[model samples]
Target: MSVRTMNRRAVLLAGGASLLLAGCTSTSAPARVALAAAPETPKSPDSVPPHVQAMYAAVMDEPYPIRASRMHLVPERFWRQEVTDPTGEKPGSVVVDTTDRFLYHVRDDGTAMRYGVGIGAAGFEWSGRAHIAYKREWPTWTPPSDMIARHPELERYRHGMEPGPDNPMGPRALYIHQGNVDTLYRIHGNPDETTIGKAVSSGCVRLLPQDVIHLHANVVSGSPLLVV
Candidate 1:
């Protein structure tokens, strides 16, 4: 997925959007289809329109490392967690280290599975603990009033936007709540790859499509999350 710049000056495409994991030594190839056909793979930047390129440049300062292997498309190191046995905590365990832009799933042997994420900006961020009160697959997006006030163009979709490739919430979303109050934040998939490791979101933490799917499958409703 791609995001418009904070200044609304450019658009930035998310990482892992248009890539295919063939082999580490394989040459970069052009995208074979439109975004909807393959949400996991994105068209090569060079094949993207000039406007798209221009928009991407404004929102992103740099690009994510292109990792490839014969067996895996992305290296585990990008997310920065050591994988342990997945048996201990089948559910109800989460950790978000905001300082490092990582969210981890605790495992049985004391190790964790970590993923890179995009965090909220100043004045719109949240920390501390929350629970995964709900989970939605391809959730609709309803930009908050504050977000709409900041960007009037979003007013048309205030009610809710349908779930699909263009929707900001890609693949899955886990709502965070504190007691009975919904935190209005989520752990969801991002459209822009470069947002990871950067403070570019409103409040919710963003993850890659593949990683988000992986985590979504592991986490259950009412799970505890520690964000420090």
Candidate 2:
């Protein structure tokens, strides 16, 4: 195979989203097919729209290297964009519609910033209202006991894995809580670019690393979040 194909496959499998934590341990798509249609592979940044490339641009100053996501891997609809407020909950409210796999952060204006998120498996999902208790930059990752049982090698990280590119938590993590109680779920970053809009994870919602950074800066402690 060509070098480009190899690179695309490598990126898709690198730290896949399913291996991410179902809990905050420490830190931290849809498609159509047509007959004879060209296979849909992740697109190079230059081949994608300029806005998308800009939105997911690589970080120059992050402690760990955070390359821009393969924007084309995710449906264009899931790419971070603004839309009219449909929740009407209130400004500054963060809403996650797991059914539609969309997260909306209502702005003071009528528009809300919508992001596509990869949710967890069935029977492992969390819904209802919660709040962002705090935020972490490159937060450490601690594999829960159950996870360790499944992958004994993770026992080494029982204490917590140092934050870095390889850390599944990516470069940012938002701790979700319900009234001072750690819900054990998080809205965190995933360096893997392929899991943005599919149900491929354990439970925690995963956002592209770049998109999470944008969200991490705008939100504050106690930001109300509704997962429906």
Candidate 3:
């Protein structure tokens, strides 16, 4: 080929290579930018509200580690929050509204720390004035005689089920009593977060383990409990 034609061909090839490199660099730049700008996975408790963070920290700082596994992701609506007290009960009173599946811890400032709860199933529902006679941490589970009768599979646990993650009483329990008599009802923790905001228990009020840990730490024995 002619010298001039050879020079032109070399120039064209060099220009094409430059454009190809430029295209590759431009395409990769956006990918790098997207990775850098991508949002981070939110940190546990920290990404939650201030009050929730405080409660979460309190639970985790306990003598026994309330591990992350114990923390279940519940619906945003069911997450604990301080709302204007709807019930006119006196401060420090625990008012459980079965119809709404919410447990309210009345505060003096006209606000209540509301937590979602699971109430007794239709036939087993109970509502009346009661008091927290006592409290237990990692309480044992003893299936009642009637409960055992209905589900013979529970006969093995008739004696007692030791306190642990699998126990019906998740991390804490508050025994409800009418005067000196045991009402055979309780406010306790349940590991199943899906049950919250539903009526699926056998006359017991169930809260999430994290929430129960917070409530257990704050509520005192002898606290009046009104289930309505």
Candidate 4:
């Protein structure tokens, strides 16, 4: 064969081998495509339903004879509602479920008014049947001996702490008793709304100030109470 012809054949063979190799590489390799990232969704603030907002407005808008304090924003989950009665107690009875941090006020219509509450922590927890021996609005707070022993600074209030917005017992208090004996435990209001749905109180059950005010107005003395 001629040198030019041999060179042309060699060039053509080299070009064909390169094309074959490229085809094999393309067939074995996986395809890759770039994709746009998804946009992040903005989180919205928590809000209450229209009815609950109305109820909250009614409680907050009411005039207070005493010095009014700023209302703290509470989680919507703690809002009061009339739910089916789970306590099996007679109407007008109060049931406290410490584990769930809920207080149910039994109603005559086979439903209970449920309120979120802050319960006692650890050793401070108590459970048993009791009654609403009495109730008070803006009640005085007398530190129990045990509580005083834990914090000597409370000694000043050992006699009694005057009622005000700063008072631990916020707007109202329900004294619990058993058979005419004072249990020394109480269901009361706390100005700190964030405490609801928590277990951080000394021993007493605490509700939101507005909630306790509503409860105080409705609950009568000698109402049966069950703490479980």
Candidate 5:
């Protein structure tokens, strides 16, 4: 098995052992278990992934909130634009507009937290509504085989890449799913702040570190995430 897979197994084993020792066999309360299972530090910014050294070097200057680009004060119009939402909000929810590159966390007060995002390329784009089935603080990124096929330079790390500052997912990830199907699209952090309001991703939603940190704090599993 790959190192990452083995690490994941070790984590599961350790968590299971702890649970067994604690005599807490209840699965009805998964939130507690999930909290216990979350990884604290998934990746490091300075360490480059396999063959992505150049791309990583371009973005490995400084951490978020301190990066020069993040402090530039972006306008709201960059991420706040209307879209067709005939179904309306379902109590507390969220919606993302790929055309305008904005994500809205709908509040009960009829307003929302507007944040800019980087969207997928034309052919790799996704539309329609999906639920946030899972959320991770710092997610590991296993480049899809297609991605490696297109960019053979990335083939070396096809299995899975460790989570860290260099990981494209940034500081957090919210996995969207339609029913039981994994959309494979994620609302994740981007170390490249310049990509904000840009349509240049491989099907995943990319957010500047500041915006992602804000979204991560507010979003929860089961939240409705509409991408259109």
Candidate 6:
């Protein structure tokens, strides 16, 4: 087992424990592929697998509103799918390969559920073993003071950003911590589908809104998360 893989299993693990978030905010830098073409779709109607389209379909009925994404904006490879468990970690653990921008949730079976991710940019990337300290739906966002300095308009939200479709933390966020300290990183949602599989976040892992929602519901709190 990799040191970064979570072994101790617990769901909703830190019940009622207040989220100790340092704010995983994104910078204004544009993605390498500023506008993607084919996120919820494949090259052609014949190319798409029925499951991929359903995964990114408009998510209504959420406590917070989520707009249906335009298909064909992000590439198909980043879409959620099942694949071989390359990490060889215990079932139920989570593994993130930053280099490939893929997050895998190992299953009891011989495969893993993989979702595309937007990782931290060159200088802001981080690695190592961590456990999900907690998770939240419609989580509040508080941008770090430095992030505010760079984007003064964010100053108005210095205290905190409310939960909404527009919130940077999106509808769900998984807080990552090392030992007892907050690593100040998160696996959260981005409204933009084009950013998947690219290094665009400040230091957090970003996923499409629907993708993050699925990951959060399935991955337990306090699950081991390995980022390499």
Off by over 4 Å in 4: 1-46, 58-73
Q: Which one is best on lDDT? A: 6
* Tens digit per residue, CA lDDT, model 5, 116-228: 67776545566666689978876677666566656666655667667666677776788777778776777887756445666566667777665676678788789976665
Give one digit per residue, the lDDT tens place, for model 6 in 33-89. Answer: 322233344555456556666777788889877876544666777878899777767
Cα lDDT listed for each candidate: 0.57, 0.72, 0.66, 0.65, 0.56, 0.75
| Model 3 pairs in collision | none
Which ranges of candidate 3 are over 4 A from the true structure? Answer: 1-65, 69-73
Q: List the candidate 2 regions with Cα displacement exceeding 4 Å.
A: 1-47
User: Considering TM-score, which of the candidate structures 3 and 4 is the better prediction for this target?
Assistant: 4
Model 1, 1-228: lDDT tens digits are: 111221121112111112111110000112122111111323354444454333223322113221221112222234434555232334347866566566778775667777777676544456655679988877888777766766677777779888766677776899887778776788887655655665666667888765676689888899877665
Over the full model, what C-alpha lDDT does candidate 6 score relative to the true structure?
Answer: 0.75
Q: Please write out the lDDT profile of model 4 over residues 1-228, one tens digit for every residue.
A: 233543344344334221100000010112222122112222322344556545544344433433221223554446788888776678998877766678989899989898978777555666666689999988888777776666677778778888866677777899887777676787887755546666666668888777888899889999987776
Off by over 4 Å in 6: 1-23, 26-47
TM-score of each: 0.63, 0.80, 0.72, 0.73, 0.65, 0.82
Model 5 TM-score relative to the real fold: 0.65
> Ranking by lDDT, best first?
6, 2, 3, 4, 1, 5
Between candidates 3 and 6, which one is better according to lDDT?
6
C-alpha lDDT of candidate 2 relative to the true structure:
0.72
Off by over 4 Å in 5: 1-69, 73-76, 79-87
Highest TM-score: give the candidate number: 6
- What is residue 59's positional error in candidate 1, in angstroms? 26
